[model samples]
Target: MAPLIVNEIISPDTNLLIAFLIGIGFGFVLEGSGFSSSRKLAGMFYGYDTTVLKVFFTAAITAMVGMLFFSLFGWIDLDFVYINPTYITSAIVGGVVMGVGFIMGGFCPGTAFCAISIGKLDALAFIGGLTLGIVFFTEGYPLFEEMYKANYLGTPTMNELLDIPRGVFALGLILMAFAMFWVGEWAEKKFPREEY
Candidate 1:
C-alpha cells in the first residue's frame, strides 16, 4: 500500500499529481496557520511566540510515531523508506546556513513559498534571494565538492546510531517533545507580544 509508485500500484504521473495536490494542501495549511506572517515566525526567535517550534516538533514526532506504527502493522515496509546519507561537515554547514537564513528572513524555504502564494512582497524578495543562492551553489558546486562530500556517514536512523530499539527511541522523542511544548508555553507567556 505504501510507496505506491515504486510498487507499481500507481503510475508515475499519478504519483506526481498526488505530490502536487499535497504541496497545495500544505501551503494552504501553512497560510491558514499564520505561517505566512514573518512577524509570527520571527517571534519564535524572540521568545514571544513558539508556534513555529511547536508545529515543527509536532510534525516530526507525528511522522516518527506514524512510521513506527505503520511498520508494526505491516502497512509499510520500513526498509523501503529512504534515509539520507549523512556528511558531517556538509550537514553542519548546511544547518548553520539555513539557520542564519531563517533568522534573517524569518521564513524557511517552504514557508517562503507559502507566503508567496498569498502575494507577500517580502516573501517574493526572499524567494528571489533564494533563487540566486541556488544558482550560485549550482555554479560553484565544483569548488565546494570536497567539503560537501567530507565525513561521509552511511545512512543510519537515530535508533541505529544509539543501538536502541525504534520503539524506545520514539518514546524518548515523544517525551522530549512534550517537554519542549511546556518550555514553549512558558516562553510565550514570559515574552508576550502584540498580535501580529
Candidate 2:
C-alpha cells in the first residue's frame, strides 16, 4: 500500500488526508497513554518508571517482526522501503542535542505536540522554543551546512554492513528487546516511586 502512494495509485490529496487521519489517531493514542505528562516522561530518566522504554521496545520489535512476516507472505514488498541515510557526525550531534532536550523538557517533539493538544502550557512553551530553534537553523544554515553534510555513510543498515541475512538481525533485535524488558522491569521495582 505504501508503494501505491509512491506509484500515485493514491492521489496526493488522498495521501495527505490519510496522513492527517493517522496523525490524529497516533496523537490520541499517545495522550491516552499518559505520554502528554512531562513528569511521567521524565520519570523514566530517574528510573522510577519504565513505561516509555517498554512501550518503545515492544513497538520496535512488533514492527520488525510484522514487516518480516508481511514480506514473507508477499503482502508488502520490502524492496521499496526507504532507508535513512547515515551521517555519523550529524546523527551523533543531533542525538545528543535531542537527548538533553528530552531530559530537560521531558518531552520529545511528538509528545510535545500531544501535550499541546491537551492544553499543556509548558508544552506550548517548549513548542515555541522548538520553533525558534528551527528558525535559527534555517537562518544559519550556511554556517552548519558543512557539518550537516559531513560523514555521509549512504543508506546503510546493519544487515548490509554486517554481511548477515535480515532474519538474523531481526532475531537478534527480538532477543535484545526481551533482555531490555527484563532489565526495565527490574529497574521499575528497584526504583519504585509514588505516582506523579
Report the number of the highest-TM-score candidate: 1
Provide the RMSD of all predictions against the true structure, rounded to 1 decimal. 1.4, 1.6
For residue 62, give model 1's deviation from the true position in Å: 1.5
* C-alpha RMSD of candidate 1: 1.4
Query: Which residue pairs clash in candidate 2?
Result: none
Quantify all predictions' global Cα lDDT against the true fold. Answer: 0.89, 0.87
TM-score of each: 0.95, 0.93
Off by over 4 Å in 2: 7-9
lDDT of 2 by residue, 1-196 (tens): 4655765678878878988999999898789889999988998898888888887788788888888898898766777788888899989999998889999999999999999998999999989988998999899999998999899999888888988998999988889888988888898899999876
Best by lDDT: 1
